[model samples]
Target: MARALDVKRLSLVRLALTSAVIVLALGGGRALAAEPERPASQPQPTPPVPAITRECQTPAGVKTAPIPLPNTLRALQQRKKIRILAIGGASTARSGPDRGGFQEVFERIIEGAIKGLDVEIVNRGVSGELVRDAKERLKVEVALTQPDMVLWQVGTSDALARVPAQEFETHVGDMVRWLRAHKVDVVLVGIQYTRSLAHDPSYQAIRRAVRRVAQREGVLRVGRYEATEALERVRQGRQPTPPDPFATTEGSYACVAQYLAQAVTLGLFARRVEPRRQRPPNPAPAPAPEMAPTPPRPLPLPPKGG
Candidate 1:
């Protein structure tokens, strides 16, 4: 009797398993495997960002103080355009990894950074030109182009030529003042830094002079020396390399351009304090007309009666 009960239970279990398999094979398998229906996702749109806000961010190893660019800002606001005259020595030359040159690269960056604004870069860079010579040429160029801003990359050649730092400062300061008088903005690009020349007095003096002039004149100054030194520090940390005395590389050029762009962007947004016009000392009240002596009137009346 126990054996019969065990066989009956085994038969019942087999029948149940067989039934489940048959049901799945028929249609339940398809139902279990099917994915639940879901609503289709709509594409999301990207928000537009202003060029000034987006591209004006300072990059690593670059820093600059904001200095007002009243003329350039006015040009941008009124004409939607800003003309830049890039004048300097060999560093400002049209030599870069990209044939477009660093000034061209600078132009592109400025235009991209400032939305709906056109940038015209007039490259007046002369290789081996000293600061004085460039200053003279700069005047002619300014007259011809009438640029809203003058990007002057100076001090490098002057320092190499051992020009007196005081003289360098005077010339730079004069040019900056002249540009301001002409309603043009000026940015002073300081001497390039190299490890070999880091301690050289003449080179360092010129660098200091550049800073002094920038401070006195209250114009934007791009401290290329600081920017390059910062880059050198970063590179040194990654892989120490022998210092090159004449280290004018395309990489450094691009890096300097980035520094310049940051300075220019900051300047563009700086507060403009217009110089107060001295109202001509209120014209001294014109002296009252001297009254012809009353005697003269009496004499005329007596003559008419006679």
Candidate 2:
């Protein structure tokens, strides 16, 4: 009786396990049958968004002629560094990197545009200085710094002082030639524009003088006057209220920096235009080779004796 009872308990446990297995198997089959098959959907790739570059943000009037900067380019290529000497009046006053200015903006633009390039800007700006004053200081600074390039923002103070246009031209032109002689490249940043000075004779004269010098010297010139004028016009059109002088001033500086970056980058890649050589006149086409006279073929044997 005891053996039979033990056998019965064993049989009951086995039956319970078997039923549990069958139930689980059925449930699993039902789950599989109830759920419909799904095809995996492939993800579509996203297109890259176009970057808004400084050039894209630049105003239409912010124009610059791409004069090649052989010295600066050479320095960049050799040392992976560009040491720029910035000298000017109020517009170019030295500022710390935290304080934004054209110099800082310029450095950022250039470094971002180029990989593995380092830019060091030495600012030597003195406010309320005339061309003569800055020129004197520039000579000293150039000697000490030995920079690869010189960024000279000029003409505003001289214009305000009512300096004679010819005198202004002479001072700037002389300094440019001197810098070139010293193997230092120069980019002339022209005067800042304002509604008050838009028609001022002295200011206009000074601006023209700078232009003439840049054209004659063949260096890059950032037309701050033109760019600012354009920006002002746009502002005037959009807003009826009086324009904010401070905002305009900031925009002017940003535009100047962008224009400078554009000019410098273009100059770096600009190829020197080699003067066309007098290609020797093609030697008169070799005299036509003389062909021996073809012996007169006897008339087809008179048509085979016709």
Candidate 3:
């Protein structure tokens, strides 16, 4: 009787399994395999921009002090143009990597930097001329061209000629004053610095004179010698600043031009002087006082005596 009971229980369990299988098949297996739906993924945030650091900067050193260019600035505003007269020292030649020397490169730079402003550069550089010669002809050039500014490359020739520092200083100072008085701005470009000449008393003296004049006159001074020397020192790391500013490339001019452009920008935005008001011509001197009364009185007295 116990063995019969066990077989009935096994048959009931098999019937339950068969019923579950039939139900799964009737549901087509799709519902049994289906999974819960998932939400879409969100996008990632954009990265922040890098701060402008000095590391990648080209190491452009501090520009020369701001020199006031009232006339130049006024001309730029009133005429939308400025004329530049470039006069060079005795050895200020037009030889450089680019066919155009500093003046040409300089002109291009100013025009490009300040949109809508035209620059007319007159290259009157007299190669091998002395400082005194340049000073003498400066007035003539001003009268002829009527430039808004004069870019004087004055010291190299004077230095080469062994001109007295006092004399050189005087010439430069005089010209600077005269130019300013005439409503023309002047920028002095110093002598070229080289290693061999670094220790030379004459060259160094001339360089000092140029500096003094620039400071005294309150005009822009392009430190060609000083800048080139510093740059070469940086380039040849661990090497003593060479007696030669350059190794093989004629690239000093390009660098000078770049520095000059920096200085020009500084000068342009410097203190804005109101355009000078023109004074009306004085009224013609009152007609010379008539002497007729005195003459008539003398004639009458002579007739009465007769």
Each prediction's TM-score versus the true structure: 0.66, 0.68, 0.65
Candidate 2 lDDT, 230-264, residue by residue in tens: 76666665555435332344445666677788788
Top-scoring candidate (lDDT):
2
Per residue, candidate 3 scores C-alpha lDDT tens digits across 1-306 of: 999999999999999999888988876456666845577876423222122123212366635887878888889878889999988843433344555566676777667777787999887877778888887788999999999999988787788789999998998898899999999998888887677778989989999999998887778998877777776665665455533333323455656776787678778776646779999999988988777654444444465557
Each prediction's number of clashing residue pairs:
0, 0, 3
Query: Quick one: ranking by TM-score, best first?
Result: 2, 1, 3
Cα RMSD, each candidate: 22.6, 16.7, 26.5
lDDT of each: 0.77, 0.79, 0.75
lDDT of 2 at 263: 81
**Superposed model 2: Cα runs more than 4 Å off:** 1-59, 91-100, 237-247, 278-306
Model 1, residue pairs in steric clash: none
**Candidate 1 global TM-score:** 0.66
Model 2 lowest lDDT segment of ten: 43-52
- TM-score-wise, the better of 1 and 3 is 1
lDDT of 1 by residue, 1-306 (tens): 999999999999999999989988876766766957678977333223223232223346355677878889889878989899988865443433575545776777777777787999888887778877777778899999999999888889999889999988888888888889999999888887888789999999999999998888888888878876866665565455644565455666676676677678777776666789988887788999998766544444455557
Residue 18, model 3: Cα distance from true site in angstroms = 99
